[model samples]
Target chain A: MNRYTDEERQLDELLRSASPRRTVPPGLDTRIMARIAAHERRRRERRAIRSMALTCLALSAVLAVVGGIAVRSLDVVHRPETLVLLLAGMGCMALTVGGDRIGEIMRRL
Target chain B: MEQPTDNEIVQRVAAGDTEAFGIVVARYSEPIYHLVAGILRNEARAEEVTQETFVRAYEHLDRFRGGCSLSTWLYRIAYNRAVDSCRRRRFFGLLPAHETLPEPDDRPRYDDETIDRMRRALGRLAPRERALIALFYEEERPIAEVAAITGLSPANVKVKLHRTRQLLRKYMETQ
Candidate 1:
């Protein structure tokens, strides 16, 4: 075994004996659990909102496609208002589906 | 009753039994707090960082792949949080206040004066150096495990460990 110098031994003894041992605060558990609960709740709410938004966007896309087909079948695709409405609906659908991806890309930039 | 393993507890927490996480918090809070307090030397900030560490751990529980022991993983998270808190405080020109040593009544091994000297000497070291000392000596972690927790190569850890011990001894002698 390597022999420790007196100073090394003293320092080791001091480190072993005098290391600070802070008692965790009494209410730390309660505080952490409350924070965790809040976080879970917020995450659940966000997931709910995202799913709802996705459902709405899916419905909007279906409506836009159907409406576009109907307008084409009815020969009303020539009307500027119908065409604008169709384009806006399609744009909204794309934004809703790709919003998170767009945000990720922007952040990387 | 025998306690569940850390892996078991982690699996339970991931399965939505959030109460299982309380067991993890209870098991780790003291070491985590002590580690943070050792570096920051401020009880309030240490407590905050300790709490934040667990919160981050919980948030990323799924990412814990059991590559390291739970304690080591938790220490890694605590270490990062403490370093970040230290940096933020430094940026704001806020230095940690000198902390008082533990009361003699609490630790009958050393008198208040010796503990105080050691604490002061520890405080004089850089935050990472203090962390290295705490991990190696106070926590009784092996050099390899310390390297894993601190994200340092094992060889680097050995060099720093030797150098930090020398510095601590020098600092204490000067004090």
Candidate 2:
């Protein structure tokens, strides 16, 4: 049969009573919530910047494509070099705007 | 109203409901503070580390995979932060070495004076030993959970708990 020792029981009671439930300072929650709010704000700002950059890049690409098609259909000039340059510019813009996200996606895949 | 589970609260926080994290903070702050304070033996430093622990939990909410209860995960973070703070303090000679207590006959009872003395004796233990005693005896955490929080094996935790109890007993017996 298991037995209880005087020392063990005393130690248990001592530890339990000694380690009282500490009262968190009233301002701690406010401070933590404020920090969380600040973190969220920074995250939102980063997302906003990324989205704005992506939108501008997309608009530019679409405009370039439409203009290229229009020029070709109107027979204004057979500028293959201009079309190639536009495509290259769009590629660079995509890389610049979404390079990190694209890399992350690819890494995940 | 039935309170949400920790996973639900974590989901809300992960979904950008930053205020939802307050629920987690309210639930854990006291215990986390006590745990940190027990190890650091400095209320100010322990409070700071507890705050940092919550902030870290918020930042890493998405990475929580529900592998363990949120309390366990939170305790683990608090434990690590307290240990780090203790090490930094020791590095600067800020933490004093464990003091040798004068042995008294018989174990001390838990009167007000004895309790105060016990608190002092606890402070005289090594930081990790204090942490082990706090988690095991005061917190009443399961051995597995304590092991997970402290990164010790279950068997090792049991052995350490035994030794820490003996040390505490010795300290408490001191005048």
Best by TM-score: 1
Q: Could you tell me every candidate's TM-score relative to the true structure? A: 0.81, 0.71
Q: Candidate 2 chain A, which ten residues in sequence have the lowest lDDT sum?
A: A100-109
Error of 1 at B3 (Å): 2.4
Candidate 1 CAPRI category: acceptable
**Tens digits of lDDT, candidate 2, B53-128:** 9888898888889998999999999998888888788789877654322223243455668877777778777778
- The DockQ scores of all candidates, in the order shown, are 0.38, 0.28
Candidate 2, A1-109: lDDT as tens digits: 7566886786777777777555556787778778778887877767766766676667667767876675576533656766677667766866776676666544544
lDDT tens string, model 1, A1-109?
9867887787787877667666667888788778888998888867766666666667667767787685676554567776777678767766777676555544544
Can you tell me which runs of candidate 1 are displaced by over 4 Å? A73-109, B96-111
Interface DockQ of candidate 2 = 0.28
Please report the candidate that would top DockQ against the real structure. Answer: 1
lDDT of 2 at B41: 64
